[model samples]
Target: MTIKAVRGKRDGPTLFVSAAIHGDEINGVEIVRRLLQHRALRSLRGTLVAIPIVNVHGFLNNSRYLPDGRDLNRSFPGSPKSSLAGRVAHSFFNNVVAQCEYGIDLHTGARHRGNLPQIRADLQDERTREMAEAFGAPVLLHAKTRDGSLREVASDQNIPILLYEAGEALRFDEVAIRVGVSGIINVMRQIGMLPPSRVKKPRRQPMVTDQSYWVRARVSGVLRALVPLGAFVKKGAILAVVSDPIGDTSGDTEICAQDEGIVIGRTYLPLVYEGDALFHIAKYKADIDEVLRHYHEFREEFEPDAYDPANHDPSEYDEDPPIAS
Candidate 1:
């Protein structure tokens, strides 16, 4: 693990930003790189703790689990006398996470999947909601922190953390990376780490959802997605079609939405078996038109004409360079 601290001359929140906790999720690594390149941090009032790659063992192997076949994320607040993953998690919690006042964990979808830019936070926390809104992602999920997860561990210590999910694992999506970098900077501004922007805030507020579910394939076949990610669909809407690749509709199955929700995640690979999750939807209580309007506005903000830093490759810092005393 590598750590970078950009401390301000004045005292402020120590925000810990971590990425690549799942190893294959490389978009967060790029997000951290781009975040370090921003000039706004020069005027920062707080400390920014950046750890671009937390699971070095998994990252080097391009695998999501550690050598011991354990997910590093599930081993939070681990013990020194336990497994390898446990030891790693224990060291991280003691030496790094223990020192921070706030945190932002970046992540992407698993293999063969893509997620729309969204913030998964505990809405029960008012400060967390404010930070999530400030991040300005199109979708906000009232996600409950899983047991033994980083968010839960942080919450125990009274540190509010936000998790940003976007793109796909093992690949960098330009749109995902751009939105992530901007979102992190926005949160920094909102929390007083950096000066506020003179430009007005985002025109459309992020759509919040408390209920989400995965629409699974009913039969084994080649899958065809009818709607893309971020699409607003009503209950019973057809989200995808599964058909036999050899031009047979006898085995076809239409995966329909079970609730009026937005498509927050979907399988990118067309081939799928029965019970495979195809479209992940999030239900909202407000008018569907409002969600549609917000989605459209978010897309327009990232039009081709707009500047995107992900279009260029930024140099990554060498991990743990020797510091001159």
Candidate 2:
């Protein structure tokens, strides 16, 4: 529960950027680290509150849920007089999120899953849509507000926010971190909290989709993916095949895409049970060619080795207090 506030000399909108609410999602934590190092923050016009680790208990335990086995995210806008998770959420809302005019909640795929870099926002709001487009991810999902989630509460308070999802939990992906850092900076600039970047906007808009679904494993076995993440697939295209490790094709089951879409997420671990989520596809109802063009440009921009964090030091994070026995 560490919050670092970088306040600008001039008065402007306060923007809060939070990460690691699920604890195991370390990519967001790293993104905040790199974001703090940017020279742009020195000239920032507004406040940037960085909360790299929110779930201290779950983070220390390498788990997504709290010690009480409650999902911290599901206990949002919580109570000061309730469970530990609820109290923590309540404290966070009051102390950190209360003052912010805007926010960006960073995240990654759950354990054993990897996600393509994307922005999930309520596009119905013009302000939110502007921020999402400014962030410049290849995919922009018009996600609905889930009950008890931070996004829901923030929207309720009329504070527009974006959820940047990428990479996988418990690991650092350089590309995801780069995209996250740059995207946050972009949003700041878009809202006049910071100076506009010299970088140009994408030639094409992000693949905006209100529809996405998980392609589940059809059988219990070792899953082998025939396609890579970010690959576009047509309806009924084979995405993966689940087969026994002992060369038993007799029980093989091929998982096919249910719609023409892009692979937004996939399972990293080969072992899976029947009905386990294997692929998450985002359908492009229109502008498929333009979307593909943007995808290639995004890859070229944030390709591996384009940015290296090894030279930068981000060790300012504090250790959580030890629990009493």
Candidate 3:
């Protein structure tokens, strides 16, 4: 793994930003690159450790697993004597992740899937919750760490880590990249790694939800998505329709929402099989209209052309220094 460390003149907290734990998730790599180029680092308070590609073996081949066919993410805090994935995980966790007080693991949806920009972290921890809110994603998901995932191991060691999920694997979404960069700067300011904004705007309050589920396809067919990502759906709303690609509607199936929630993720591939996951919906207690308003506002705020560092105030909480073209 390649590591880049930028230390500020003043001592403060150490934050490690990692990407490509799933090698095909390349958006985070670009996010890390832009972050390292931001002029804000010139005045940063502590050290920023960036690992743009943690699963080098998988990245080299455009695959999501190591050469051993093991997922690097699920082998975290691994034993040195274990398999290749485990050993690599062990080295990275010890030499890099273990050395930081806080962390941000970047990710994207699985291949052929796309996720709405969101923050997934254990919100029960006060520090983690604060950082999640400060990250300023449109949605903050209260997710439990998996058995052998990086978040689990880091949390076991008392490190507050946030996982930012957006875009799709092996693809670069400009909006997602910009959001990732801006969110990191927000978290740094919140953690004292950077100064607080001189211009105080109303912080974007992300809709928080602990309940979410995947709507699966009932039959194999061509999928026609009726709802877009970030759409607020009502219980029983038709999310998509699955019918024979040959235009036979006789056995068509309408995938409907099981509960009222927001669509946070969905598959982009039109072809799917029986029981395939098609949409990810997160339930919230807030008003539906209010939630939609929040989503719309977030889109406007981070629209590709909306983020121009040159026109942005350097001390603003949501803005960072210019990144090179």
Candidate 4:
């Protein structure tokens, strides 16, 4: 594989965990690295293929798409001779990924954005949904699978892949890292690839959303956000407003809400052009209030400050004399 991969021992199943398919989405990259160094893997039952980075070119450039202006994640099952990104994707699919029975592709929002560590997958696929639940990120999105994605290609091969979205590109958020790491470990346990789950679960299952849309800026200016990730809002509530940097233009135009939902994701950068996506609101059926409550409680419970692997000396995990390829 063009990308670097680390494999573990055991005979149960092969599970693939990949990150940085979108170069700027570094949260997953770190998650995969930390996962590999996790002490729990000492007792892992199946082979765990951890690819900390899938799109090296874009990762180096700190951009989301490939150098050829293609999104690597969308160029899956790619041709070996297509392009730099394509070759990388092709090699990964034919090698590391093809060996897996279950997979979790981690990701984060692009520049200036943040997501609440949610699992977006095809709920109609029973196995896919089960893995999502096993992943155990606070919110689960029952999204329709998109085209040209690793998720799509893996599904074709009968491998269940759950896409975990969190944090932001280029910048790592502590909360995002903790949730993602715990979630992936949870998935491994659920698939019989790992012995047991260390992640604590809620009394009820996750809230799944069928569709989600972005709330954009109403005017070009600086933004003062009133609602953060996982906050609940009613129809017509003032989520945020576009204010002129010069404090002009009707004293800041308010961006009124168009629907009642929870903020699954939001942009971190305050400055915006008039139509830039500022908030991602996913609609749900029942338990609207319950969703928000669960999100915050879970987030607090997994405070990123307490789990710094660096301080904990993660390298202690690389002890097997570096297994051969």
Candidate 5:
């Protein structure tokens, strides 16, 4: 309803697509901007409200937390009597989000980390689960809602909000960005707010995993990961090894997998100390090999080679492709 919150087209179910709630998590900002400019939305049957940069201060500084050192994502549905971040969240929730029938929140891994494109939702909630499936992201996680988080607050209100995680903090990856923009459009199409999509074929629905753990470093040293995000690993596999930068004595410096699953997030900063989170893996018993294949194929469809962006340039892939919408 306000100027900062830009809405495109009126007269249909209002869908809110928000990004940069964590300030430094900006991949979503670009995704939302591109989403607003999509030509396909011309025939949209509903209002699309896009807030590209939610926390302008932290976004400018590439800081994940607000100036008050509070994580904005954890301050949702806040109060006017609270701090700056809280007030903004409260206002947006009470005014903009409250008016929407469905919502999508885009995000990325924290600083010094990278995440495979995936959706995190409370799959236990019927509506939330539906939207997560409709989102059509390469993978989906049925994570429980954290207290004070936007997803939790919205769920409490019975509003289904899908949280999309990908890329890395303070920077952007072209593939992750592409996946996010396309995913949002697919969601719009799924809800019948927009016409059917024409892009890469939709990926299979991701498995629902309730438990996840961040594999952290037990010894401080230079680290080398054995697999990247989206890679499948069997239980008891060697995930990573840490040693001195100059290859000093290797005295028990390794992290092993606790269960069979796929790597959803990993650290980029090789240098680390004891107790630093290195990998975020979700435990699942599904055909993870198929899940991994879908993850890579989803990205490959948009590129001729992951090493060469010139291969599947947007200009080249710009023909009619199967889109979720």
Candidate 6:
């Protein structure tokens, strides 16, 4: 419930960046931390309100739900008279989200799963689509807002919002973190909260898709994945093989893709049960080679080794102590 507001010397739009609605998704926490330390804020035009942890109860226990066993995310625009999760959701939505003109909710894959860096938003809206493209993640998913979720409520208020999904729950992926930080800055620039970048680079045209489905394990066993995240696959291609953990090869089953698409998400843990989601495939009508080309360029642009604090403008450096992981 801690909120940090950084106001610029001039007036502009107010953008709120939130993380960890699920508590266990800690990657967004780091993204928000690094974003606050960015020197670019020195010349910022408007306001940046950062909420690093939204579910304090779940965060404390390393769980995804409140003590009442309720998901805070599904309790949006809640009532004070409702349950614990609803009350917290009410307070945060009204006091924080209600005041922002734009929002970016950060998240990660659920427990034991990993997601490629991607932007999920209602791309049908022109403003939201612009913001999503500006963020420049490898993939852009045209996701419909779920009922009772923050994005749905925010959209109802006419406040454009973007949801970023990456990495995995409770673990940090350096690439995902870096991409998150840079993507936020890109959105700020796009929305006129920050100046345009001086260094001209290739603009990111993320692969866009509205169709996706999960490839699930056919049998309960240990999984050996044959493909990595961002990998392209044809219809009926082998994505993984599930074998008996007790060394019974007779029951091995090869999980195959249901459609031609890219691997956007998958389970990281080898142990899985029957019908467990193994690979999240997003189908794209664009040429596969072109999609992959953009993906590679996105990776090259945000590679960790390419960034050095000392190489940045002196004003970009902040004295804030690093957050403990």
Model 4 agreement with the true structure over 1-325: per-residue lDDT tens digits: 2344444576778888888888889988778767877887877886777788788888888888888899887788889888876787788888877888888888998888888889998888998888888777878888766777898888899988899998878887777887888788777777786676556555445778787788888677888898988777788889987887886767778986788877888887778887898889887658766766777678677663334434555565443221111
Local distance difference test, candidate 1: 0.87
Q: What's the TM for model 3?
A: 0.93
Candidate 5 displacement at residue 119 in angstroms: 0.6
Ranking by lDDT: 3, 6, 2, 1, 5, 4
**How high is each candidate's TM-score?**
0.92, 0.92, 0.93, 0.88, 0.89, 0.93
Q: Per-residue CA lDDT of candidate 5, range 1-325, in tens?
A: 2223444465667788888888889889878867766777778786788888878788888898889989888898899999987898899899878888889988999888998888998788786777777776766787878978988888877888899998889886777777777778777777778777566564575656777778899989888888988777888889998988775765648788888888889998888899999998888887777766666667675542423434545665543222221
lDDT of 3 by residue, 1-325 (tens): 8999999999999999999999999999999998998878878998999999999988899999999999998998899999999999999999999999999999999999999999999999999999999998999999999988999999999999999999999888878998999899999999999988777978766889999999999989899999998988889999999988788788789999999988999999999999999999999756767767877888887775545756677577554432332
Please give the range of 10 consecutive residues that has the lowest summed lDDT in model 5: 316-325
Give candidate 2 misplaced runs (Cα > 4 Å): 201-203, 306-325
Point out the higher-scoring one by lDDT: 5 or 6. 6
Q: For residues 1-325, what per-residue lDDT tens digits would candidate 6 score against the true structure?
A: 8999999999999999999999899999999999998989999999999999999899999999999999988989899999999999999999999999999999999998999999999999999999999998989999998878999999999999999999999998888988999999999999999999999977856889998999988888899999999999999999999998888888899899888999999998889998888899999766778879989888776555444545656565443322222
Pairs in steric clash, model 4: none
Please give, for residues 147-172, the per-residue lDDT of candidate 2 as tens digits: 88999988999999999999999888
**Counted clashes in each candidate structure:** 0, 0, 0, 0, 6, 1
Superposition error at 285 for model 5 (Å): 1.8
Error of model 6, residue 136, in angstroms = 0.7
**At residue 199, what lDDT does model 2 achieve?**
76
Cα-based RMSD of the predictions, in order? 5.5, 5.4, 4.0, 4.9, 4.2, 3.3
lDDT of 2 at 42: 86
Measured with C-alpha atoms, the lDDT of residue 175 in candidate 3 is 80
TM-score of 5: 0.89
| lDDT by candidate, in order shown | 0.87, 0.88, 0.91, 0.79, 0.79, 0.91
- Worst lDDT run of 10 residues, candidate 2, spans 316-325
Clashing pairs in 2: none
